[model samples]
Target: MRLPLGLAAYRALSWRAAQPAQEPSAPRPEGALLWLHATSAERLAALADLGQRLCAQRQGVNLLLTVNAAVAPTEPAALHTASGRVGPVLALTSDHPGLIRDFLNHWRPDICLWTGGDLMPNLICMAAEQGTEMILADVNAASLPRRRGGWLSDVTGPCLMRFDAILTDTAETATHLRRLGLPGRRIAAMGRLSTGASPPPCPDTALNAATQLLAARPLWLAALLDHDEIAPVLAAHRDALRFQHRLLLVAVPADADDTANLIATARDNGLRSADWHGGDPIGEETQILICDDSGDLGLWYRMAPLTFIGGSLRPTARGNTPYEATALGSALLYGPHVADHAAAYARLAEAGAARCVRDTASLAAAVIQLSAPDHAAAMALAGWETVTESAALTDHLIEMIQDRLDQREAAAHARA
Candidate 1:
């Protein structure tokens, strides 16, 4: 095949310098390997949920996850999360034509989910020639490669044309691609590629009972409360109630033993307390209701629009995922110690969906600020948008990927 002038130029420049050596990796896993790529760690965060879903849904499917010249990840072929294996993570090789071919030859992925707009000419061209199924997703105009040289005829259009399908995050992005000469049928406004797990299940009867019982009281939840963190949480809640006198704090302990400490802290703060397990009555004077040690947070999340995740105040902040709150229409508040879920919290913080508190004072202030209906509503809306921005479209796309993989595997077996 004749190389387009733009692609030819790209290949020449891409290989002008010595390509970095590919890192040593283990033998590829046997099965239908699905490879995914993003330009940076932040972009890679969007793929984590997808990778986890793929790995969980189809045990036979192997994932090869990569980031482009961004921070390299340890492990290969399957992305890993705390709970299970998503797939191996690696840094993509520099776009040198030879290395590109070498990398593809080694992996031999059945399909590629390429995050859209940051087109790699040599890599795309090589992959296309090798008959790899390429799908461009989360297309954004701002993410497209900017013109560095006028002399190089635009290669983005041609590189994108190689993709089997181009799904955009918005109609504007689809329209932008159309202006680049991609056909209408080839592009669809599929919204963003983002992920959030379903909110914890809360039955309607329980939700309505709690909502009516609260009777317009300012409410906040501190869930998965660490033993040491209980004191600080109660202190913050007590401080918050000074200004918002009708405030109610619902607490859920991380461990059953932690319940004793929580009740003691509430008493120390001179706040009236109700314990779910102890069968203490919840009356108008009751300010703290300790949820039954079940640690089921769905009911509390639905009861309160403001949530402060526990365990985030310690040095080893094993914080909860912020999506659980955002997915349940609650605004998030966490502490300085969120290394485990830094990307998720960062994403939410950037969008004004979450707030970070350094100490009890800040947590108290956040609670007070969120007490106002308008303020809480705005943050809740932002949380909903930030966490769920691309959830539906991404879910559909994931299903499509699975179906395609299944079809290919079935055909391959027949051929064998």
Candidate 2:
């Protein structure tokens, strides 16, 4: 029952590849290994949430999670423990691949879960060789061009095929993988792991304040706005102001300091603006509210009936998550370059739940059109429908993981 020599070699190479300059001398524990590479703070939060959920559902399961040092510098950070029995989440940095290797050697986990990008095929091969179940959750296939050339073409195909279970966000991705030679049985359409049913809960007081401030005002949230797109966004904001005098624009700047420039831009374009940096109460006459803080998009999305997702306007930035807004009952308005989440956005737009604006002018017009009471309500309804349709897929994924664990335990009992 030993794994093939090639597979064993692959694991050894992978472990060595991940080794840091200075090796740790301490002994590691044996448990479940979860390798996560979250590019955004939002994704990092999601991983933490998933870890908490898993630990709560399954007791006696030791979990070791790896994050990039840049993302989470501090090791051994406390994760929100599920039922308090699954042990504290031990966060390790991948800055020293050697440290990662040392930790893996010490903690021989039963299952290995890889999240985010940065696929290490050798790691997958190693996990398989060790008789550990390998699951790649929230996995995304590279865009077509990226797959065609260079080192990826050689390594990606074989590396991807080695996984015991590959869960992707969309059917389009599954088809793409099959085209790349991954067996259909091994690849399942798990929808997007980040697309959950609810937004992170916000304080009731803040929610009430936002609601009261938005009463009878045509509100539009332009989230994650980059610096280069500011001019066009301001132009669109002015256009919206012409029709709806009581227009409210909530801008979430891409950079924290960019908030000052955004407010200045709005004023330069003859639009009245205010800042919410100090947690001040929004005055009735405030035309725009600049939210400079982080991790409050969940609350803002819920406060608005219509939202224009930023980072799409200019060619520089691709896009941010529209699912969060849709899940919070807001109609989506996006620009081009949304290839990252193209499938989900396409589905929502086709269903009349979302609109993709080609430019600043189009964005302005769409906002005005969508702001009508009846039109806005219909879009919100369609949005909720599109988001809830994936509920079954979520449940299926949870069930699949649980069933696998149960089967593993049952087999162990039989052997004993």
Candidate 3:
């Protein structure tokens, strides 16, 4: 009485093919196409960063992200997905030949970037046969299959050589790849690709209004403060207020539960405060602005030139990302407990983009010194450069992809 599932699926496929090649939500069909495949969603996050960079630079480039269907929902929430923005995600469990052909024909990616382990042999061979340019990145020795020296020994060797570029994690992986039949010249050991956070959009009118209201006020922000960090932050503000009487402190807590304690502390220390959530006005006499709203970080980061990222004054509380503030032209001040983002903090420190303070005395001293316009301007420039450091690898990948595309175009033209 009912049709079989396979038969219905085939009919649906036929209907889709008959309608059109392009989906309305997808990018235009005439431009360059990039295909990205990741062994896991974690790896996909890094590849998605690369895709975002490529789309930002190239005028008409389309990206298609592919991942295993099993791990899509459970992927870590901290990582950036860029789903549906750059392109749609294609979930491939097992590569059926007919389905693979349909997907390739529909998207027709000009360049392909695959990350992590577990290469699909059929997909690689078919894509190679169709002359698609491919790159393999973030691979390691563990990614290779075992059980060699048999009738089917090294069966996927030729397929592995299809990639134009291969970047592995360690020198051992590079050695393993060369032994696996991929040319030594095409493979190298490089560090993992970097991931960057997208800049949150801030409305220009709102930014202008805030800037006008806070005109000529020497201000700094204490962002995402924890309960343990309140005393040190308030003490630092108290010390800094001595030299600059007109100085303002924009205090925002990581948890709203600490809000009442913070306001009580500010008033107890003889500082006039304005509670943003309680409809209090920031009059000329207000020394501390308590922003109880957690969602308006974009506003504070832009309003203040120097931001002290909270939750790092104590050893137990690790810090948040420094790029979010640096990306908005804010110079950073943080304590030493930055184990969560050690690489980013180290880079910013080395570049002279940020300063490290141990206690309230040191924090107050650094705040007073950085309040000078010339010093803050130079530090802000360094911080901006540090946040955009991913552009180096991005440019490198773009050059390689473009060169391969040019070569393929020339070869096709010669044949014609």
Best lDDT among the predictions, by candidate number:
1
Task: Enumerate residue pairs that collide in model 3.
Answer: none
| Model 1, runs deviating above 4 Å | 12-19, 54-59, 73-85, 148-155, 202-218, 226-229, 253-260, 291-294, 311-319, 336-343, 346-352, 372-375, 406-416
- Per-residue C-alpha lDDT of model 1 across residues 1-416, encoded as one tens digit per residue: 88778777877888797877777676888988888887654456667778777777888887887777544553221234521545456766477887887788898988999985767788887888897788889888887765765312477767887898889878987887787677888788888776576678888887787777776777888988888889888999889989988788989988878877887878888989988657677787989988855446888877788888887998876576788888888888999887767777888999998999988899999898888878887888999998877877778778889888878889888999
Q: What's the TM-score of each model vs. the native?
A: 0.81, 0.59, 0.60
RMSD of 1: 4.0
Model 2 misplaced regions, further than 4 Å: 1-29, 32-56, 59-198, 279-284, 403-407, 410-416
**Top of the candidates by TM-score:** 1
User: What is the overall TM-score of model 3 with all chains considered together?
Assistant: 0.60
Q: What is the lDDT of residue 357 in candidate 3?
A: 91
State the lDDT of candidate 2 residue by residue for 88-173, as single tens digits. Answer: 33444442334544555666766666665556555555556667677776666652224335323554555666678888878888
The superposed Cα distance between candidate 1 and the true structure at residue 49, in angstroms, equals: 2.0
* RMSD for each of the candidates: 4.0, 8.5, 10.1
Instruction: Write the residue-wise lDDT of candidate 3 on 93-189 in tens digits.
Output: 5555556676677777788888776776656656766778888877766666654562112434555667888887788878877776668999988
How does each model score on lDDT? 0.79, 0.67, 0.75
